[model samples]
Target: MKNVFSGDFTQGFPFQGNMTGNDPSGFPFQGDFSKSETQVKPQPEIFETNDFVYVKLPMPNKDNKNLKLQHTNHQLILINYPKENEQSKYMLPSPVKRKGTRARFLDDYLEIQFIRLDESNISEIDISY
Candidate 1:
């Protein structure tokens, strides 16, 4: 018998799943990961020429008006509110300024521009800084 444990086709090394079928019984999150599983990884494009950081959120089919942008002394919070999604808030991973920030609503996408001031920003105010 071919050792399933030592073979590449086995579920030991590159494990696909224990089930033979696509729809596993006990396993969850097999399909439909476009929603509720992961948030659109915020893509921040720093426009040094314009002194503004253009942020593009990859939230497809989501209402642009529902998106909210807020910044604290610690991190830049990008809150995305989908009309069809449950109500909740998400804190951003980076610290950015709230002031001078602008947002625009596009086709099912929200494009925001965070003005990077030449002066001290929220990140600079960190205690460790």
Candidate 2:
């Protein structure tokens, strides 16, 4: 019986003899990944500091009069943006209070600042196991 852990174990595999000479990383597949039709749309940038959570989104060819912004504790919503009657929703990094939100549109970018909600009131539960 042949040992499966031997060097020749890959002889009967489907990827056998499929290694390409031009691939420096020695991957078994061959394809020009750079020519692939995978395009990435612009995504919102989110960051949080000690006091605030910031979300910056690109608003190319957009106007403040045509945009509407709304938010809950966990999500931020943009309406009438990028196109008429179209809306985009973004998730916030942390829970935010509804009162202290500030939004500004400048230089083709929409920046929203949300005050972080205090979540440090965790209580220890006694397990009755």
> Which is the leading candidate under TM-score?
2
Taken over the whole model, the C-alpha lDDT of each candidate is: 0.52, 0.80
- Candidate 1, residue 38: the lDDT equals 56
Model 2, position 8: C-alpha lDDT score:
66
* Candidate 2 ranges with C-alpha deviation above 4 Å: 1-41
lDDT of 2 by residue, 1-129 (tens): 266567666655655442543453555665664423543446999999999999988987754487889999999888886567878888998999989899887787888899999998989999997
lDDT (tens digit, per residue) of candidate 1 on 85-120: 434333333444568777775664567666555555
RMSD of each: 8.3, 6.7
lDDT at residue 47 of model 2 (Cα atoms)? 99
TM-score, one value per model: 0.40, 0.64
The alpha-carbon lDDT assigned to residue 25 of candidate 1 equals: 49
Quality of model 2 by C-alpha lDDT: 0.80
